[model samples]
Target: MKKTQYSATRVDIISGHLTEVVDDLRLVDVADYIAFIRCELFGNIADIVNSATELTFYPDTLTFGLGGEYTLDWNTAPKVMLDLEFKNMGVNAYFRLTLGADSTEIDLHHVRFAETGRSPADNTALLAAAFENARLPQLTASENLG
Candidate 1:
């Protein structure tokens, strides 16, 4: 008998829009915080990537201000794959998230800003800062489900 793989579908359970200007080092901090939020929503980075197959939320997770007014179907246009949307010094920013080869690693496949006022170097620096600050959530024993 052959074993069947059980793949899970990921859903857009949460979304956030910037309420304040995020620039300088704050941009990185916000990115890290969002990453932590993702880990909290899912058991791990792998679970988040596998989310395309399944959408499950962690028990008692706090996701304040992350819920958007609308939700897009997983296969519809303007899909709900965006993990973050922020404003950097007034520029509309976004991130498309993906998982790295390592099950524990989460990568931001795309980072785009709606405005074109900043130079390429400035944007790169901002993104690098975000990646540097990104950290996985370290859930407590009680919070960690088997």
Candidate 2:
């Protein structure tokens, strides 16, 4: 419950699969969604996560995944989900972010589909969907967090 503040400049995203699509996504929110996720991770640690993140969209599905957990002095780490959707300029994408307990580094993965013809961005008008939820916030570290 710490009062963690957020800034858009903090979250940096580098797309591994489609730079053009990522650029389009940024054009819609101007990186607000990315910043919010970074804010959630930063809230867990006293300082911000300065590590560089490199994520790629699924070649087939065009979906991306990123997750990480911070070590907390407290007994348990909180689990939360933050989902985001962006629709603009013939681009649709979904982001699903989550935070849990016990981890040092962050990992980015491409969500694979069992079917051969599974495309996340099938439509141009808000057709793509990705979800991201981050819950690490140094929940019980400082008194201010309550």
lDDT of 2 by residue, 1-146 (tens): 11122111111231222333433432323133335445654332211111111232222233223432323345765443333232233333444334343321112222233334533333211222231211122334676665
Angstrom error at residue 83, model 1:
2.9
> What local distance difference test score does each model get?
0.31, 0.30
> Candidate 2 has what TM-score?
0.22
lDDT of 1 by residue, 37-103 (tens): 5455423322333332222222212122232121234563221222433333333333343222221
List candidate 1 segments past 4 Å from native.
1-82, 99-117, 126-146
Candidate with top lDDT is 1
Q: Assess the local accuracy of residue 137 in candidate 1 as a C-alpha lDDT between 0 and 100.
A: 41
Q: What is the TM-score of each candidate against the true structure?
A: 0.24, 0.22
